[model samples]
Target: METVLIEHFKKARRLFRILLVLALLCTVCIGIAYISIFLYAKIAGPPTLTVPQTAIFYSSNGKVLDELHNGQKRYWVPLESVSDNIKEATLAVEDKRFYDHNGFDIKRIGGAIVADIKAMSKVQGASTITQQYARNLFLEHDKTWTRKFQEALYTIRLEFNYDKDKIFEGYLNTIYYGHGAYGVEAASKTYFNKKAKDLTLSEASMLAGIPKGPTYYSPLLHEENAKERQRIILNLLVDQGKISQKEADKAFVTPLFYAKKAQDEANAKKQDASYFMSAALSQLTNELGITEAMIHSNGLRIYTTLDIDVQKKAEEAMNTVMNKDSDIQTAFVAMDPKTGAVKALIGGRDYKKSPFNRATQAVRQPGSTMKPFLYYAALADGFTESTAMQSEETTFTLDDGVSTYKPSNYNSYYANNPITLAQAIALSDNIYAVKTHLFIGEHRLVETAKSLGVSTPLKQVPSLALGTSPVRVIDMVNAYGIFANGGKEISPTFIKRIETAGGDMVYEAPQEKKQIVDKRLAFLTTHLMTGMFQKELNGYTTVTGKPILKYLSRDYAGKSGTTPTDSWMIGYTPQLVSGVWVGYDQGKQIERVEEKAYAKKMWALFMEDALEGKKKQAFKAPKGLVSVNINPETGDIATKSCSKKYKAYYLTGTQPTTYCRDKGVSEEKNQAPQKQKEQDGFFHRLRDWF
Candidate 1:
């Protein structure tokens, strides 16, 4: 029996030895697998971090107009650069052993495991700063055993390959902050309009506390929660010997620095000269293969066409008037007539209230402001400025057969007498303009408007003579610039140049001018129209019963127009052409004032400020155009007995050769009867006597 037991014991020992050997082999194999993964992670590059191009717009003077982002993601930033207090506080609250540990904290991991097991929840995370960065850069945020294993391996690799400072920098730069902010640098600028290097302790601590879960503790959002988190971080910093208890106590008492609302920030950014230029930049970025990220990071020096002083004045004027009434929205566009460079543009009272820019986006009827184009076209079609047309109140039946269209002057007074072309334009008589349009045919008028950069489609109807076509304010302004520019149409351009992020010029806008109309005709039209600003009846009165013509103190010309709702005043000097449109977004009619209040007020404000110190340069007349003293009504050369000897100007082709026989008087009885008889000649005398 003893012998049998010994043999059985020996067999049991042999079985135990075999099982131990197999277990050891399995352990060795698992260790080898982990080591391989760790090595691979150390040598392999991280997955590519893709950044979507941010949309940035600038004003003409290099001010930011808008910044649009499609994605809500951003990178992390270093804690020290983020904010000193924030860094210490965050280190205190999260990963207290961050600086001391290699890659893992066994004590924290053990404690987390115990707590997690007790709560039956995955509430505790045992990730160190290095491990967290490793997971963020290479792995997904999943709480699985396999992911954790991969994270540990990568963390070890990161620790070996990167220095402590680099690892911290990467960790901070890779984590997401709330509010679409990625790194501390971006967050600092976004929240405080400052850089990370300028952050205070409290600011830094607040930023540092955000990454634990940005949404739950965003300073812009839940300030109370953010404050609480900040306090916790401060305490942690105190406990870690990074700061004093008294310092932490003082920090706790400090109020949280709340950031401005997004809308407010957007407004602040736009109140600079570069706002529109930034907008142009954004457009060009897409067209020129440059990205917004490159622009932000590359620190580009963009030279634009904006005059800073003019832009400031425009913004100030708009703000002053915009504050007066809430219902009215005003738009102003100014351009260099010579170069077509947009100098100043105010889209609306506040871009936040309505981002729909009336200057560039809203298409409204230009009202009678379109008369200049028709008049210019008439001159080009061999219609002399002195040529007479019947300006009596007239009515016409349209093919539509809806109603009889009776066009009258703005004052509803038209003499049933012959009026010259210059009189028709100066009086802005709708009937005369419509009759002229009919005489020339609608097709020719449409073609003329198109030739002058009127891209809006016009209907072949008589009503078009009254400027009923839908057009953008910018387009209308450019069209008027053609007359100012001696018949050459230069398309408006906002961007001066676009360069790559690396300082290589990628796109430079070409200044191309096309002659769309005869220089002689343009000059003639401009010469005759300049009369509108000379007289009080030409619509240059002030609100206080004063004449604003003297304030202009220069040779300028413009027209006032109003439809049912919109009021427009477009004018030009030798150097600048500007247009102002005043109306409501909802399209409501405005009461007309003799002073032309709304549009005239805006126009005068823009021009008086825009041309403050400029020379009073006269519009250059094309060669062969001449000015002559004539009777205002007859458009004939004025005699000594003429009642009103206005200096009537006309192109040589359109000037009247005959002098007024009765001088300035329209009726023979107003002048000497014998002189009038002599003016009528012997043939008329024979008929009269018979």
Candidate 2:
């Protein structure tokens, strides 16, 4: 029995020696691998630690407008700017031996390995701050042997090159904290409405506990869970001797205020300026020769020309006046005429439902709004405001005589008599406009519109006089700005300046102004537009703007145009020019009378609110123009005997010299009207040909 026991003991000793040799060999292999990785990392140098950051947009009022990021909100700050409370709490919860370890915590790793071995699964992680940061910067969060091996190499690289504080700072800056926030600064601002450095002990602990399970410990979503985790972190800090028990207990019971709820409440019912931001971003990318991807990743600071008050007023007006149940879309744009800076822009009624920007994109017929340009062309081509045409329904043979063209006024109502240009404009007389178009040459109106900054293509057709060409709201608003700013054409500006995250200037919009039209003709045309609201110009029909007369508080020159499918109202004061278009997206005809009136009323309401606190400005008349009171019926100079007359402006040589002969007055009865000199003008040629 003793011999048998000795044989068994010898077998047991042999097995033990074999196992010991294998263990030593495994240890030596691991050591060599570790050394190899360390040397390789040292030769590879430090990795590029910089990550994509959030970009900020500022309004003209110096308020933050919005933030742009590549699907994650991240703001980087130095370690010195972080609060000590957060650092201690993060260390306590994530890695207690973070400062002592080279890159991995051996004790924690051993514990995790033992736990995994007992459970027969790799369910536990013992990543130090440096390791987690390396993974965050370099690898995806997948549980695999390959990922772990790569993570170990990067961790060693980071530990060997960067100091503890920098590693900690990078870790804190890149850590995910839920709610799209990827950094401590963003997390603090998201939860507490304050900077990371301003966070108190309670807030710091709350934010520090989120990186473990962002969704599970989100204070905005799971406050109780977050509080419990925060308490655990606080206790851990107490156990680590970083804070006293009393301070931990005090922080555990402190009340916290979160910005998420307040922000949600404020956003519950608000106009989103996403459309304007989209436009501004497009301008930025186009001007800088960069892509939008660069804007999201480069941390640019964009200063835009949006007026918060005006934008709000414009949205409020749209919301207040538009039909809630109807799917009819609307586009509105307001701009500073003097600078061509867009103050407010509403692309569509709702951005989420449809992101199509009608203000800048939609091309629809402008209807009678095109008349002003036609008249401007005429005035420049020797046709005075006193120029007269028969308003009766008439058919004219086209240039190809086989094709005859007939046009009718609104509701087929006309004077069936001679009407002056001033009266025709106030009434939107279609026959008179067509006659003038044919007489002045169709190409002349196109030239006038192009010179006034209308970029939309226009055809030299007779129907073009009645605004048959489709145009964008923004382009039309800019066209009117030429008249408002006294013939200085300008391109609309969205961004005032752009800078890098480090405050280096990237771009600045150069002020571009060119004199594209005669100042006197622009001023005169602007004055002509004002006649739409003049009651004295009422003839066969009330002025088109008569419906909005009660809403006017100050003088404004505007034109309202309507087609079967679209309605437009564009106008301007000396300081501001605005335009609105109301129509269905599918070009459905506006059947309701109230819907047809939406454009005019909305324009009046928005303009009133936008100009509420500003000083009223008058249209300054340029030099070499004559102002006179004229009779609307005769286009003759007005006298004391005329029943109705209004002040009109004209070029120096174009003012009428004959006085109107009223029914009761005989003083001017003997004065025959002076005939225009027979020159090679369009009217004389048309008369001779007919």
Query: How many angstroms is residue 50 displaced in model 1 relative to the true structure, after the best TM-score fit?
Result: 3.2
Candidate 2's C-alpha runs over 4 A off are: 1-43, 97-101, 106-124, 284-288, 661-690
lDDT per residue for candidate 1 within 1-690, as digits (tens), equals: 999999999999999999999999999999998787666866674433333323344445566544545444232344455555545555676677887888889999999999999999988988788888888778888789999888887787787767777877776666677777766666776676677778777777788888888889887878789888888887777777898889878866877555556647766754553335444554557565556666554434344566666777777766655546457787788889877888887777766566667887788988888878888777766666656666677788766777677766766767567666666676777777898787667887788888888788899888899988889898888888888888887876776775532357656767777787888777777766666665522321111212346456667777778887888888888799988888888887765453246676667677888888888887766677777777766767777765555676555534455677673344323444554454445324323422
Give one clash count per candidate, in the order shown: 28, 0
lDDT of 2 by residue, 1-690 (tens): 999999999999999999999999999999998788878988999988988888888888888888898678888888888888888889989988888989989999999999999999987889899999998899999989999999988998899999998999999999999999988998888888888889899999999999889999998889899999999999999888999999999998999988998878867754478889878877777765757776787778889899888999999898888889989999999999988899999999999899999999899999999999999998888777777778898998998878988988999998988788898999999998998899888899999889877888999999999899899999999999988999997878898888887789988877877788899999988998998988999998999989999998888998999999999999999989999999999999999998998999999999988888889988889889989888887777888888778788878756766677682232333222342342225456645643
In model 2, which residue pairs have backbone atoms overlapping below 3 Å? none
lDDT for 418 (candidate 1)? 65
Q: What's the lDDT of the predicted structure labeled candidate 1?
A: 0.70
TM-score of each: 0.72, 0.88
Question: For model 2, what is the alpha-carbon lDDT of residue 150?
Answer: 93
Clash number for candidate 2: 0
Candidate no. 2 TM-score: 0.88
